[model samples]
Target: MRNSSPPLEVGIARWIEVMRRNLLLASIVALGVFGIAAVVIAKLPNVYRAETRILVNPQRISDKYVSSTVSMGPAERLNTLSQQILSTSRLEAITTELNLYPKERQALGRDRVIDLMRHHITIDLKQSSDGPSAFTISYTGGSAQEVATVTNRLAASFIDWNLRDREQEAQGTTLFLEKELATSKSELDALEERLRVYKVQHLGQLPNELDANLQTLSRLQVQLQANSDAQNRLDQQALLSRSGSYDASGEQGENPQAGLRSQLVARDVQAHRDLAELHSHYTAAHPDVISKEAEVASLDAQLTQTPASVSSRTRRSGSVASPADAQETSIHHSRDHLAAEQRQIESSINNYQSRVNGVPIREQEISQLLRDYDTAKEHYRSLLEKTYTAQMSMELERGQEGGSFTLLDPAQVPDAPIGPNRPVLYSMFLVASLVAGLLVIALRERLDSTVKSDGELHDILPHIPVLGLIPRISKTIVNRSPAQPTLRRAS
Candidate 1:
């Protein structure tokens, strides 16, 4: 006999049995996937990382020109120097010396090692956020010890570069100034010579005053000539009177007005001045011009009314006027007047020359100014050149600077491996189990089709006496395998 039951419990049992069967299949598939994943993960190569830290401080802070008002700050100088270290040329040197890329890099003749070094390297600057300083260097690499070694090398190189730069900059600057000094001195000397020559050639010469003196001398000379002419005429008249050489009767006679040969002095000067103005303004036939012209003619006639003559010592002692004495006195008077005018002119010329001679001194000052300008320019250029050299040297020194790093913590060998994720393996295994279980369920359902249950049993034998019903147990929940446990099928 079999035990009878409702369909609901049997359905629940079958549902659970199906899930159990699926779970078993899933487990098998999961195991296989997890094993493969584990092997693959283990076969991958491992990479090790290395790092080093360093600090930067000035190695030599000796101030040679502390008194100089203009100088650069240390930080500015250091930073500028640091930037120059990133150049490939410097890296190439280090790489060659360190056997970094390969010894065959020299043989293969490829400078590609420089690029490799740059790629493998990393520099991290650790600046103080709270302080006014930023001079730390950090290098990282795949090789643990190599990173530190390279970092150390960089510091050393930078220091060497800095020293060399300073030395060269100083020497070079000095040389440049020296050359400029030479050129400036030469220019100054030439200017001096020119001034000296000018002074020697134009000694005791004056320009502005000389012209003024010359004009005065000319006027005075004219006056002296007039005076001499008057004196000569007076003497000549006197001589003529003594000899009775000329008279209105065309014979030698004495006349009191003869010695007094002074003409109408300055009388025609106004008329001459008016005539000149009229000549510029109008034609000579103007009315005012004709009246002044007639007046001038009348004055001339009055002045010529008396013939110029001189009286002799007539009958006082019956003295004969000595012609020889008169002639000698006239010559002596002419010589004396001419000599006085010449003396005045010479004195003026000498004064002018004396002033003109001072120009050479002024010229010398100009020459000095030119020399100073040249010297200053030369020094400026020299200093500029030195600045560049110093900057370059500082950069190299910073790069090779040995104190750029500090060993905060050194890496030590570890006893256990850091990783191959074991939990991820377990999760993968679970996922594979679900997939395989579903596949098995679908395949079995397709092959075997059945609809046997409690309701169907009642329908098949309704006339038969229903004695008992039995429940089908799920294979998954049975808790025993055919090979592991004794089993019996329900009947």
Candidate 2:
């Protein structure tokens, strides 16, 4: 509080007074900032965002493995496939359809507005912590309604496109499987027809699995033929035995060797030849008669001792120890030989019949095999029919193009301005004002310099002559319109 204060305070007095002339510079800075901000706010267009949502569901359709002849259904493979479809070229194609690009401002035909348009358009896919079962897709743009419209259109279009693609695939698959089914059916039909004809020709015979049956039948037939042959041999022996009494000249009853034997049995030979001695010595019905009877008994006993199935006459007449018995014995010997040959043939026929009894079981097995073949053929035919039906459905679906994706929602008018963020604008203005105030103070310090009073001027250049000096300007500067009075004199 000394009267002179410090020398430093006096030195800064002129600088402080010069710093106060800051009005004009502040006005200039304010006007410039305000003009630029107003132009930026007026030219900028408003942008708006809109959104839409939908749910997609899947369904089931099969027995064990869900066999399909055409393209498989969506529900069968939706999860992984749907995601792949979403992020594919199919989605990019939408951009082409929508013509989403900016308009240019240059003389060149190129568009600068396209860059701004890109900034306006935004596509976002939202996932949740829950699961991958569902997701959301959103789009934002210059207008809220346009965003909603595009989202819905894209969603519908993608669905229709997916359907069309499936239909085409189905048709292709159907055609391929159909050809196979047709060929298989043709082959099956041919086989069945041939089998039918074979059965008809063979009469109750099934061709499939018939080798075993045919073999068994052949063996039976052979056995029957052998039995017939054996029977024929037996018959021939029987006929030969019966015909032993006949001569070889085809006569029914004549025996050439029987002549002498007949004579030996004849009453005249016995009476005339053997009676010569008897007539000389004995009367009829006396000792001679008894002796003749004894002789007849002994010859009959010899005939009875031979086999009944053979010719006893031959055995008994073959050798009468005397010459009187010789001629009749030869006929009996031939009869006995024929009877033995007949017995041998009969034994052979019996042995053959015993060896032929194992042929019915094999025939039954062959019949069963034929049944199995028929069943398999039926199954093959059924599959062929189903495949054909599927092919037809696929073809129909393929023919239909340009499916759904209809306009559920279209573009709409926007309501609010989207640019020139207000809080940021005001904040910028406040900062500009502070900077302008500081700059004005600095500029005024350079423009105003005074050495008016005695003490202040003597502070520096004290030896210079002090003439009557101009006083420092202490009057308050009032801001006014340019048309008003203003002080222009130098200090």
User: What are the models' TM-scores?
Assistant: 0.44, 0.45
lDDT of each: 0.52, 0.47
lDDT of 2 at 182: 73
Error of 1 at 454 (Å): 12
Tens digit of per-residue lDDT, candidate 1, span 1-491:
13375667866776676667567665666566667766776664443334444444433333452211113344544555566675677776776676665654765554566666666555555556542233434444444455557776665555555555554544555566556657766666665576567556654443434455456545544554454444444444434443343343332333445334333413443444454344334334568857876876775575568554433333332566545446646655764564465345434534544454454564565466556666666665665565555554444444443113233444332333324455675577557656665666667656754645544465676667657666667777576566425555432
Give the number of the best model, judged by lDDT: 1
Per-model RMSD to reference: 11.5, 18.0
Give per-candidate clash totals.
34, 12
* Residue lDDT tens for model 2, 1-491: 32367777865864554444455666677667766666665566655555444333322233233333334433333433445444435444544466443233343232334334344434333334432223343455655556666666655654565556666666667677677777766766776676566456554333343555445544544443443344334334433433443333233334343443333334322332242234223333457745764664554454345322223444555643423123334434543453344234333323322222222443454455456557657767776666666665554445432121222333344465454476587678657765776676676555658554566666566577667755544345334434225445321
Candidate 2, which ten residues in sequence have the lowest lDDT sum? Answer: 401-410
